[model samples]
Target: MWMKAVLVALLAFALGYLYHTNPMLQNQTLHLITQSIPQSLFSSQHEPNSANLEETISRAWDALITAPTRQWGRIAVGVNACIDVVVSGVNLLQALALDPGYGHDHDVLHSKEDLKETFIHYMERGAAAERFFSDKEVFQRIARAAAEFPGSQVYVGGNAALMGQKLASYPELEVLLCGPVGPKLHELLDDHIVVPPQSLQETDEFHLILEYKAGERWASSQAPQANRFILSHDVSNGEMSTLETFLDSLDEFQPRLVVLSGLHMMEGMGRALWENRIKEFAVAIADVRNEAPIHLELASMTDREYMSIITKEQVLPMVNSIGLNEQELLFLSQAGGGPHSDLHSWSGIPDVGRVSDILLWILEQHGQADPDSEAHLTRIHFHTLAYHVLVTVDGHWRNQRSTVAAGARVASSQACGLQAVDVSKVELKAPLSFYSSFTEPKESLVLDPSNPVTVWQRRNVSFHLSPVLICKQPLRTVGLGDAISAEGLVYSEIVSQLHLD
Candidate 1:
């Protein structure tokens, strides 16, 4: 101890003169010295390890199963409903029965040939993307081709539709779903879900979902992660036909929470029409804003112009909370005129430091932190393949650990397409070890098995990150994000006694 103290004193004396003359050089020297220190020296906290991973999975499930559920909480979900025609691991050329010519640049899908090219474009890069097909028959053709695959199935698809069903599963919660429910969707939805008296005469909108697993090969294209790309042609949703009907029922139903989505459906409907629809949505959201917490679940919007309008005019002032995936998160930053607005999209797991920075920016710049902020955005639940991060204002949100754990748990179960996640069929896909922030890599956020939910504070908000138990064989990738968001909201409404860690 005496020798170490002497050495420290000698080093400080040697660098003290340099520190006063050139602070940058002295700081750099200190950084080098600290960086040389081994990570094991900081193991007193918790290091992310295999044992910790297994324990976290166990604890997350325990938290979900025992979390207190909100009862009699009236929740309104609306603005889109669709039948998803799902096809997994499809061969783009064989499905279309046409050669895309591979090297051509077809940014927009117009004809059938353009559709094949766009799919190939994203597939080769292992990216998840959505393309709007203006022609209704173009989507129908893809649906028909999907039917040729043996195990292809049809499921409820849409932000409003899928989330309403998941929330209604609690039995105690009163879930009012506002959308056109054709005969097929009505049959799939639970009886607990209240379908408002709306236009039942409308034809069912269809979304073709093509799913690809990591390492899934189609010709020269291979996927980097398990994900799905959506293609939509909606006659009803594109027009905002149900907005008035939904807003009319808001007074009588008197929801505690209002969830808005599917505005992205208006992307390809031209500027004037789409802008007008977003303005109407903004009004609808504002009407319910005072009565309840409004959560916006974001989806794919290929049009940057539309993204800008929604972020600035609509989402900035009305929505209180939000749920989005990695791609949507980056795109929101890019489109919303945030700090990283230049960033368009990202593939695979995004960097934690970057994601954290964006979340902080949204909360500070436009969230409820300020007295004049209209949207009063209090909470953000961001989920991806590897992990789930929940950001919330100090006094506005509670039980964050359980809320985030529920999100991570549901992500695994729903992706596996199982009512209950099988422990044996899952693996720890998260990074064994990760830093709290890339800017401060010395502060390692090692996963502690005893404490599954990693908690931290920065400025006015609290951040919670929970690692996910990824399913080894994903039976269903579609609707997983919706399931995660729904589950997170369910637990967020009420504090749990069994789980707070």
Candidate 2:
């Protein structure tokens, strides 16, 4: 009896030892597996492999069955092992959901690093797929794949904020700009722009033209001639007659590019109408089979809250009516899905840059026939969008400015291997009523700095000149030159558009 008891105790000790060392015997769940096996599996030192995974796990299971203390350790070991299997399965499922094409890339299990990279690629694929789907579709797909990726949350508001910001910032690049009410926008001064209203009747050759409402500020700024452009302000504040007049003008002008600039200024003063203007315009254009492209540039009013509601509840719906595909539509967003950058306060920089490129592309396409025609000359348009924003509310402004400068300086240092950025080129467009631009208007968008997809493409045109002098409000007048010459860091938001494969 003594010999049998000793033998049983020895067996139990051996089994317990095996279970402790073996990963297979351990639980699959992160928490339970931690309890069942030693912490070495997760350690960076020990590389994970399929065979090792199997072998270690099997030993853990064997411990529960063969050990003398099997009864005591069995429950915990079994639970841990089960948890591990589930967790691994979950990881696999999540990856597969992200990319249906996964597993075809490789057959045999390799190093942990390889597995991690593959997993990340799949996750990215899944995210891209999700962007193409609607809310309902996303919800359905996510529900099916829920067990695969743990701790994932879906935004209920959808991509409204993302899309709105994109559209605001990027206007059509190939736009036939025609306007006089606003200042000769610095961005489009060189391209086929028609200034002042009188020149509109003279030129009927161009397909599209942007026009603005007439005002005292505009009349003083009128150019020599105006191309046959669409009228932006035929309406009397809220009068329906404005649409009638606009349609009539469109028929007469027969322009291909249309733009409505500074429309939000009217909205702020309670003179603006046509809440769903984009949708209505789409319907009207479709009825007439108008091949011209239309664009509306609106600045937000004082209350951002109201702007949000309008964009989500009204503007987005209108944009959809204009027939944008999934990818193209998303490009209009401020977020990744669209055009808005998290950097600025829904203030557009990137989107406008994109639009400038697109407009240049369109014009270039048209200009190919008569390459040297003055009509194809670069025209830059600058629209000033001013909102009632408290740029420096309270004392938080000073610290925020410092933080911004510090971040820029750091970025410059890393990118150029220099302590400070040199402002080699500083270009400024003529300042209009609300804003100004300084970019060269006639350039094409360059898709890539290196290995660009299109030879004809140039980066989006910047509205502001390079090497901007940023300073605090209090120091604006007195310390402006000192800051630029002494302390300020000059940088550029170099725009680069990607070509779809």
Candidate 3:
């Protein structure tokens, strides 16, 4: 028995050494890791029974043929910081007993106790971010390690040390987490932590994710057709001081690209408050624009009902680009009273022509309604499980060559990010099978030269679609959107810089 144990240990050490040193072996190991993850970990309890899934996949392939390519460069991302406690494979109906008529799917939880209880339940189930770091030194070490990616700097505002913890692994990346030093936040950060300019002195808040597996039968408590809910303790996030601090960080970081997220938590807080916050943010962004060009992108997992408030208060005068899923786009169309308001239902597969029309309508409405507004949306992106579609207005900051290439790169990075999360791997890179899956041709839809409905072209805007690498059995879907948005935005910035050089 002793001899056998020794032999096994020796073999394991050898294998580990080979995996570390050999690139091919490392790739094989990643593939094996991806394949070994259980479908139950992230698959939805309700599977699609309709035949439209194949149709959607086919349309996505047709869209991929038009993807353009470009050179890549280095970019920095400055984000309003918040922690995401991702709890996968949850049954929304069973866990929250949510009623479908409450509001809409993906609404924020208003009750603090209810939110706390949900967090506790998921923490017991081995969810990450359960415990705040007891020691500030340990937290700093972890954060420093995660920010190692070369030519990138991540400035996390507010007191989300846990969110910053993940970026510590990328040693070459520069990372800064700035916020007040309260007893709670102080405990999370070192006493010597340097607060960034204009940082608010307040406690941190958390974003709770009760993610259900894909293909699950669970119905949305508020919207029966919907299957997910993203609850956040973000009422404090809307305070004037917090917004000011976030703006200050923007000035200090001077990031080329900014991703505005977590605004849905401000629901029920009153329209005045929302308007004030947006005004402040817009003003700050305008100030920054005087020094350098900044690309502003808005990404949210908010409920459908909040689209109106967001469109009027935030998006109209500020955002240069918007990234959302198909459902969100449909909701935006309805909220904006566009031509596609009837598109309330999704049939698993997304229609490229319909989606293109919705985007065009959104752009046209923004142009007509806010004619006096200085900022115009240059790009509108809709990402679905099947593929990603990007519509670029002709005179936007990016040209066709750059936008198409950047979109394709973003799609590829998103596929790897999803696969990595599904398999519990932290690396952003995935195996070749992942890339191949995205570009593979399917026989469902063929492009015709004479077809009247040009799905990829409208009046002043041209659309670029790239099919995603499908994970037939996903293990987790909670952070996939954020992963895609963040990676894509960073990659786009990099490509833009390279083009400038």
* Maximum-lDDT candidate: 1
Worst 10 residues of 2 by lDDT: 74-83
Per-residue lDDT of 193-214 in model 3, one digit per residue for the tens?
Answer: 3346445345554443444433
Deviation in Å, model 3, residue 258 alpha carbon: 2.9
Where does candidate 2 stray beyond 4 Å? 1-243, 271-290, 302-423, 426-501
Q: After superposition, how far is residue 359 of candidate 3 from its true place, in Å?
A: 1.1
Please list the C-alpha lDDT of all candidates, in the order they appear. Answer: 0.73, 0.25, 0.43
Looking at model 3, how many pairs of residues clash?
Answer: 31
Per-candidate TM equals 0.84, 0.24, 0.57
Off by over 4 Å in 3: 1-79, 88-204, 217-228, 238-241, 294-306, 312-314, 367-374, 395-455, 493-501
For candidate 1, write residues 1-501 as lDDT tens digits.
Answer: 465556567656866776678643544465454345433322323444423345446654574444544442788899788888888635644667775347333434677777666776666655666667877676677767776677788888888999998998887789988887788888788899888867454467778888888788766666676777777777688786888888888889988778888777778678888877788778767867767778898886666677878778856556778998887788778766765566555645666667887887888776876656655788899988888999997877677888888888888777787777667767665654455554433244545544667887776778898888888888888888888999988888522222112
Number of the top TM-score candidate:
1
Candidates sorted by lDDT, best first = 1, 3, 2
| Weakest ten-residue segment in model 1 by summed lDDT | 492-501
lDDT for position 419 in model 2: 37
How big is the positional error of residue 495 in model 3, measured in Å on the Cα after superposition? Answer: 10
Instruction: Count clashing pairs, candidate 2.
Output: 71
Q: Give one digit per residue, the lDDT tens place, for model 2 in 390-453.
A: 0111211122222223222222222222333322211111110111211444332211101111
User: Alpha carbon lDDT of residue 156, candidate 2?
Assistant: 9
